[model samples]
Target: MRIAFPSTEKLGLDSPVYAHFGSAPYFVIVDADGGDVETVENKDLHHLHGNCQPLRALGGISVDAVVVGGIGRGALTKLNQEGIVAYRAVEGSVSENLALIKNDGLPRFNIDQTCQGHGRNGECIH
Candidate 1:
């Protein structure tokens, strides 16, 4: 499966996972079966409240799922509509989150569990 992780930097598998999906600077795409990895800049990183377009930010890169610390309800819904699943990520690097996924430790993201706001006040609900 092709998994995408919101990353703070382009450090490949060692990159720290960013807290907010919409504001993350980079996305680390990993091929689970092939062990291949690539980094892509979030083009639509900046946006007004309730206007996060994650798919556009992804630049059309095909991904089976996303592992993130937090995500907004709209973004989560959009991802679901597009057939991409989102999983709540643990507090760690991309590799650590991957381990959690392999162990079935991460929970599938739901609209009810999405972040309440844009995380501007440092209150991420995820």
Candidate 2:
């Protein structure tokens, strides 16, 4: 199976997951058994929500699972509707996060929780 982890930098295993423009995509594709890794730039479709196309963008890839810091309910619903497992409360670099996910499995992301609307550091609240 192919696993995808969102990250900040392309190098390292724990680079942290942050959005560049409402689209914080730092996906790392890895083999389930050997852990072989390949990196892919996730399409930033946050700006193209005019017709709800982000889901299509994500679906373009062969990702089975996604690890992200935080996401809104709308996005979460879309992911779930598409049969993609969404992991929340995640933070770290692409490589390190992948290792953590590979070894620890999916962590509790608190999907029901909402942020109080903070700026910058709290921009991902939802």
Candidate 3:
């Protein structure tokens, strides 16, 4: 499966996962089956409040799922509509998050769990 992780930098697997998907600087796409990884800059990083377009940020790159520390309700809904699942990220690097995913330790992101305009610390409020 192709998984995308919102990142603060382009450090490949070791990239630190950004707290909020919409404002993240980059995305690290990882191929779970082949262990390949690539980074893409987030095109819609500067979107206005509540105007995050998750797909646009991906720049048309197809990914099976996205792992993020937090995401807004609109972005989560958009991702669901596009058939891409979102998972709540664990506190770790892209590589560590990948490991958690492989072990089924990460929770699937749901609309009810969307962020409530929290700051960078990623404290999502229901």
Which pairs in model 3 have colliding backbones? none
> What are the lDDT figures for the candidates, one per model?
0.89, 0.55, 0.91
**Per-residue lDDT of model 2, residues 1-126, tens digit only:** 566565555763445665321354455555666767765565664454323333454446766666666655555666667677766534446665565666775574444842323367546544
Lowest summed lDDT across 10 adjacent residues in model 3 is found at: 117-126
| Model 1 score (lDDT) | 0.89
Error of 3 at 30 (Å): 0.3
Off by over 4 Å in 1: 119-126
Candidate 3, residues 66-103, lDDT tens digits: the string is: 99999999999999999999999988899999999999
TM-score of every model? Answer: 0.93, 0.67, 0.94
Kindly provide the TM-score of model 2 when superposed on the true structure, using C-alpha atoms. Answer: 0.67
**Stretches of candidate 2 exceeding 4 Å from the true structure:** 12-15, 19-22, 45-54, 108-111, 114-118
Clashes of 3: 0
Could you tell me how far off, in angstroms, the CA of residue 20 lies in candidate 2 after the best superposition? 8.7
Model 2 misses residue 70 by how many Å?
0.7
Model 2 residue 30 lDDT score: 59
**Shift of residue 18 alpha carbon in model 2, Å:** 3.0
Number of clashes in every candidate structure?
A: 0, 9, 0
Report the C-alpha displacement of residue 2, candidate 2, in angstroms: 1.7
Error of 3 at 108 (Å): 0.3
